[model samples]
Target chain A: MTVAATSIGTPGDLVSATASDSALRRFLHGLPGVDQVGAEARVGNLATRSIKAEAKRWALDLAVRTIDLTTLEGADTPGKVRSLCAKAIQPDPDDRTCQSVAAVCVYPDLVAVASQALAGSGVAVASVATAFPSGRARLDVKLTDVAGAVEAGADEIDMVVDRGAFLAGRYGEVLDEIRQVKGACGPAHLKVILETGELATLDNVRRASWLAMAGGADFIKTSTGKVTPAATLPVALVMLEAVRDFADLTGTEVGVKVAGGIRSAKDALRYLVVVHETAGAEWLRPERFRFGASSLLNDVLMQRAKQRTGRYHSPDRVTID
Target chain B: MVRRPAARPVRGGERLEVRKTYKLYVGGAFPRSESGRSYEVLDGRGRLLANAARASRKDARDAVVAARKAGPAWSGATAYNRGQVLYRVAEVLEGRADQFAAEVATAEGLTAARARRAVEATVDRWVWYAGWADKFAQVGGSANPVAGPYFNFSVPEPTGVVAVLAPQGSSLLGLCSVLAPVMVGGNSCVVVASEARPLPAVTLAEVLATSDVPGGTVNVLTGRTAELAPVLADHLDVNGLDLTGVAGDAALAADLEARAAENTKRLHRAPGAEPDWTAAPDGPHRILTWCETKTVWHPVGT
Candidate 1:
C-alpha cells in the first residue's frame, strides 16, 4: 500500500500529510471535469461491439466468474442464505462447465452462515457493513459493524461511504472513515462503495474514486443497490477511468465492482467490453473487476447453456435465487 | 427514331421485385430475430419465397415479457371496445386480401380461387370473434341459487398471458381461427406461427399493427415449434397454452403439457386431424379455453 504520509509537492501523491487543506482541495478541483455527453456516447459506442460465437461463449463464462451474487433484503433468512450459497457453488447443476461465482454477498448477520455453507468451495463470503445502504451511523458504530462482519468470517467487506460527509465537502472525514473501515477489516479485503447514485455528479464520482483509492480501498464500488440510478453505464465508465488513472499515479491497482440494475447477459457483456477497452485486459479478471448482482448470473448461465446446447435454456431449471 | 413512342420504351421487362423481409412482432415493433438467424421459406414447388425469422428461446422469453406488459390494460378494456378492435383487425385484413391470398396460394399449393376463399373465411373468422368479445361472458357466466342467504355469481375474467401454437397445415385459416378467439377474451398471446408456412402469420402481424389493437397485445414469432414451444411452456409468466398445432403429435404435446405443469398453466389441445376452422363452433371453445371463472358472493339484505 502507498503511504499517505508524503511530501506535498510530489507529482502523483493524492494524499500528502504536508499538503494544506486548500492545496488538497485544489488538487481535487484541479482534476479534469468529465464531459458527460462524450462519456455516454463513448459507452454507447463500446456497447455495440459484437462479441459473437467463441468470444461470446468465453465472455459469458468469464462474466459468471466475475459475479458477486448478492441478497440484501431485510427478510433474508437462513434458508435463503443457504440456497444462495448453494447456487454460488454450483450455479448450474446440470452443466459442470459453469464456474462458481467470485463471492456470495449478504448482510453481516448471515456472514457466518454463508461462510459455513460455502466452505471448501472457492467462492468467498462477502458481507455489506458500515450501516450498509446508508452510512448514517456514528463512525464508532460503523467501525463496529465492519468489525462484527470481519469477526464472523466475512472474506470481503463492502462498506458504503458517508455520502452526507462527502457531499458536505468533508472530504477528509470521508477519507478517514474509509481508512478506519480498512483498518477494521484486518485480513479481509475492503471494498469502499462510492454510492455514485447519491454522489450527484461525475466530477464528484471521480473525486470520490481518488479519495477511496488514497484511503487504501482494495476495490472501489459503484452503489449499494438502494438508489434510483445505481451503477449506470456512464457512472461505471467514470469509475473505471478513475481506477485506470490511479494505477498510473500510485502504481497500486484498485479493483472496481458495479452493483445494481444489471440484469442480463447482454448488459454484462457490454460492461466487460468497457473494462476490456478502458482498463485493458488486466482488470478483466474477477480479482480486479466484479459485478455485484443477484439476477445477472442466471442470465449468463442461460446464455452459456444456449451456447453449449444450441438452444435456449429454461429459467425453471435454474434455482431462482 | 422515326416515330416517338407515346410512352418510353421498356427495356427487357427487368423490373426489380421488392421482396418483403419478414420479422418477429414484439411489443408493437417489428424486429429481426434476436439470434440473427433466419430460415429459408420455400413454396410448395420448392422455390424460395423469403427468409423468415427463426426465433430462438430468447425471442420466446421476450414475447412473454411483451404479453405480460400488455395484459393488464387489455384484460381491463371494455368488452365493446375489444369487439371494436377485433372488427378493426378484420377490416385491416380485408384491405390486404389479395396479398394474403397470394401468400396462402404459394405456401399451400392451393388454387387461386381456393386461396382467395380461405382468405375471405379468415376475415370472416375475425368478425365472428369480434361479436364473441362482448357475448362470451353472458353466454358462459351464471348466477346460482345458493342454500345460504347469499347471492353468488360466477363471472369470467381474462387469464392474463397465453401462448398459442398455430395449426401447421391450414396456415392462414388455422392461424386466424386460434388467434382471434384467444384475443377476443381479452387475453394477450404470443403465437408460434406454422413452421413450414410462416409468411401469412407475419403478414397477419402487419395487419394487426395497423388495426386498433394495442401493441404487445398480440406478438407473433415465426420459427421451429419444437425448439420454441418448450420455453413458452416452461415460462412462469404465461398463464395458458393453446396446443392446436401439435394435435397429431402426441409425444410433443405430452412433453409440453408436463413442462407447463411447472406453473400449472391452463392447456387447450386440439383433437387429432385438422379441424374445420370455417365451422360455426370455433368461437366459444377458443375464447373459453383461456378464461377463468371467478365466483364472488354478496349478502342478500342491505
Candidate 2:
C-alpha cells in the first residue's frame, strides 16, 4: 500500500460536530473510562503467547519492516543520520533477504540529510517537529517547524501535543493545534504524539487518541522518548482499542506508533501479539502499526539471526548504531 | 491449682521449620527457574536437604544477557572502586560467617569447627583477591624494554563475561576460589554451583546480593552442572570459561573445551581433579587468566 493512501480523509460529521470547547470536552468525557486492572491483566495474559519457529521469523521480519528507525537526540550529526539510514536500508548486511525498515525518524533539521541518504532505498524519512519532545512553543513556530520539515523532503512528520493544554481540559485548543499542524504538514503524513507518559491516566490516553484523530492525524504516537513511562503495554492497549473503535465509527484506520523504551525482540513480539488481539489482523501491516525505536532494530536482527543459525546470537556480531 | 496438677507429657513440638527455597540469582533478582523445575538437594549422607532451582538452558541464556548488560559499567569502574566493592563483598561474607559455616557443615558433611574454618578461609580468600583488584595490573602488566625510539607499555584489562563451574567437592571454599579471581579482574561471571552441594552457594548468593556488589556481577545458578555448563561454554557472549568444577568429569570437560573454541574463548581447563581448595596461596594465575593485555605505544618525544 502507498504511504499517502494511509491518510484519514476529511473529518467526518462526528469529528466536525465537536468543534467547540464544551462539545469536545463532553464528547471526550462521555467516552467510556478504562478499567485499569482489566487492561493490565489482559496485557499480562497476552504476553505469554509464544511466537516460535516460522511464526517467529515472520514476526521478526514484519517488525523490521514496520520500524521507524529513530534518532532524535540533541547530539545527532549528519554522519550519524547517514549511518542510521544505511543501517535502515540493510539491517543485516550479511543477509540479503532482510527487508529495509519502513522509515527513518529524525529531528527536523536532519530531515534533508536523512532524505537524501534514503532517497531511493524505499525507506521514508520521518521528522519530529513542533518543538518535538516539549511541544512548548508558539503556534506559528510550530507550524513553521512542520513546514520546514515538509519542505525539506520529510515524507512523515511526528508532532507532539501540548500536554499542559490537554491536562487543563482545553480539549478544543489541543485539537485545534493538531488540526493546524495537520494542515501545515501538507503532503507529509501527520503522526500526533500524545506523550502518554505525562497524560497521567489511561482515560486521558483514550481522550488524547480520539482528539488527535479528530484533528486529522494519520497516526497516533504514544510518547516523545524523553519521558519515564513511555509506550507501556497497558497504554498501547488503550490506544489500540481507541483506534479500533474510531475506525468502527468513522471508517478511518489511523495507525499507532509506540515509541520509547521498547527494546528486545521479546517485548516487540509481545506488542505484535497485543496488536493482533486488540485490533484485528488487518492492522498488522506497517501502514497501521509502527515502532518508534532506536535499539529495537538491532535486537530484532539478532533474533532473526538466531533463528536462522539455530544458535543464540551476541550483540558483538551486530552493528551498534 | 487442680489444672496445674495434671502434668502434660512433652513429646513433639507444634512448630515447624521454614525450610529455605533456594532460587537462582540473575540480574540481581532471585527468580525460580523459567522452566519451573527444581531438584532435591541432598546432604552428605544422601538425605533430602532442600530444593534448589534446577536451571534450564534458558536460565543460562538469561544470565548471559544480564552479565552482558552489567559488563560495561563493571569494566569501566576505576580499579580502586572495583577493589572497594570486592572488599565490601568480603565484609558481608565475614558478617555472615556462622550462617555459612552451618550451611557448609550440612552440605559437605564437615564438623562445625571444620566448616567454620572453611568459611573463614573463603572470606580470607575474598579479601586476598580484593587486595589484588587494584594491584593486579602492576604485577601482570609492565613497560616493555623494546629496541625502539618509541615508548610502549601493556596493561591488563578484564575479558568481558566469564562463566565459572564451582567445584563439586568443596562447596563454599572452591566456589569463592574461582569466583573471587574472576571478579577481581572486573569480569562478571555466571557460576553454576556444585550440583551435589549447592546449599552453601545459594547462601553465598544471598551474601553477594546484600553486599555492595552489583547485580549480575555474580549470578549463581544451582542446577545440574552437566546441563548448564555446556550452554555457558557454547554461548558466544561468554568471553571465558573456567572448567575447574568439572575436573572429575573428563569427558564433560573435554566437550566444554571444544565448545569454548567456537568463540576462541579463554579456557581455564579443569585440573586433573578438583584441587584441594584449602591449600595455601597460589599466584595471580587465575586472575590473569581472565585478563587481556592491552598494549599502547607512543613516540618517546611525541
Candidate 2 at residue A115, lDDT? Answer: 93
Q: Which stretches of candidate 2 lie over 4 Å from their true place?
A: A1-16, A19-21, B1-14, B77-98, B111-117, B299-302
lDDT of 1 at A270: 96
Error of 1 at A298 (Å): 1.8
Best by TM-score: 2
User: Candidate 1 at A112: error in angstroms?
Assistant: 3.4
Highest-scoring model, lDDT: 2
Interface RMSD of 1: 4.8
Cα RMSDs, all models: 6.9, 5.5
lDDT of 1 at A280: 82
Please give the lDDT score at residue A131 for candidate 2: 95
With a 3 Å backbone cut-off (N, CA, C), the pairs that clash in candidate 1 are none
Name the DockQ score for candidate 2: 0.52
> TM-scores for all candidates?
0.74, 0.91
DockQ of 1: 0.17
lDDT of 2 at B147: 87
Looking at candidate 2 chain B, the ten consecutive residues that score lowest on lDDT are B1-10
Lowest-scoring 10 consecutive residues by lDDT in candidate 1 chain A? A1-10
